[model samples]
Target: MLFSGGKLDNQALLTNQAQKMADVPLMITFDGEWGLSMRLRGTPVFPKTWY
Candidate 1:
């Protein structure tokens, strides 16, 4: 599982390398059910609305 407190640039660099080695295109997606800040540090928190 991915965690917080990591540089996004580093992650992108790694993803790029993996994509090149991959035979098929990889679709990267993020699930921030809570907020971006929950997974990625230093980002603005987009809180979810609860009813």
Candidate 2:
């Protein structure tokens, strides 16, 4: 799996990148474990507890 780690926000850009990765089989993920608001603006942050 591949993680973007909050560096991507543009759909067109992501599409281009996915195309480039098409030759390889992998999964892409983002950092939302904290909250979407932490990575993306204008969204509400949900609280979570980590053990």
Candidate 3:
């Protein structure tokens, strides 16, 4: 599973790596509280937390 590490943010790099591991399914895990844009750019961001 992909986590909060800044390594996987590169789409081109991820795509290349994923192609190499075609046998395995890739899963991206994001913290719902922060939203997917927490690390990467050009994504939706929630203003506040539910809790």
Candidate 4:
């Protein structure tokens, strides 16, 4: 699933929902150009060292 937002609360709910239905691999991708520090709450933030 894909989502774009800076709201922590909304992201939390989405993450919880994804966890409950853990049958599929949830690839949560986000763009941080505008500052991703806020949208990445309660979730693992990948390092940009590779790409």
Candidate 5:
């Protein structure tokens, strides 16, 4: 999984990128341990697991 420009808040952009890889079997994945909001801006940040 790739996070362009450090962060990706646009789902459509991700979809568009995935669509571009139609021929290849892509497994789009992300680090959930940190949570999506942790990487995305303008969203409520989830508490860290250690917290």
Candidate 6:
């Protein structure tokens, strides 16, 4: 599970590292809430509360 500012960006980094170590399968998973943003890119804020 990787929760960071950049999801796909982070995945690329991890993939590179994994390739260096050895060829292996890497599964990246994220919470559904990842698509929601309260004030992303300076837009109107819609506060979200998880759980």
lDDT by residue for model 6 (1-51), tens = 343344455556776787677656656454436352421232334656677
lDDT of 2 by residue, 7-50 (tens): 44563377567878798754656667776666765556687778
User: Considering every candidate listed, which one attains the maximal TM-score?
Assistant: 1
Tell me the TM-score of model 3.
Answer: 0.45
lDDT (tens digit, per residue) of candidate 1 on 7-41:
56766777788789989988776666787666776
- Candidate lDDT values, in order: 0.69, 0.61, 0.61, 0.68, 0.63, 0.50
Output the number of the lDDT-best candidate. Answer: 1
Report the number of clashing residue pairs per model: 0, 0, 0, 0, 0, 0
TM-score of predicted model 1? 0.59
TM-score for each candidate, following the candidate numbering: 0.59, 0.40, 0.45, 0.49, 0.48, 0.33
Worst 10 residues of 1 by lDDT: 1-10
For candidate 3, write residues 1-51 as lDDT tens digits.
455535334754776687688887666555544766676565666686766
What are the root-mean-square deviations of the candidates from the true structure over C-alphas? Answer: 2.9, 3.8, 3.4, 5.8, 3.1, 5.7
TM-score comparison, 3 vs 4, better candidate: 4
- Clashing pairs for predicted structure model 4, backbone only: none
C-alpha lDDT of candidate 4 relative to the true structure? 0.68
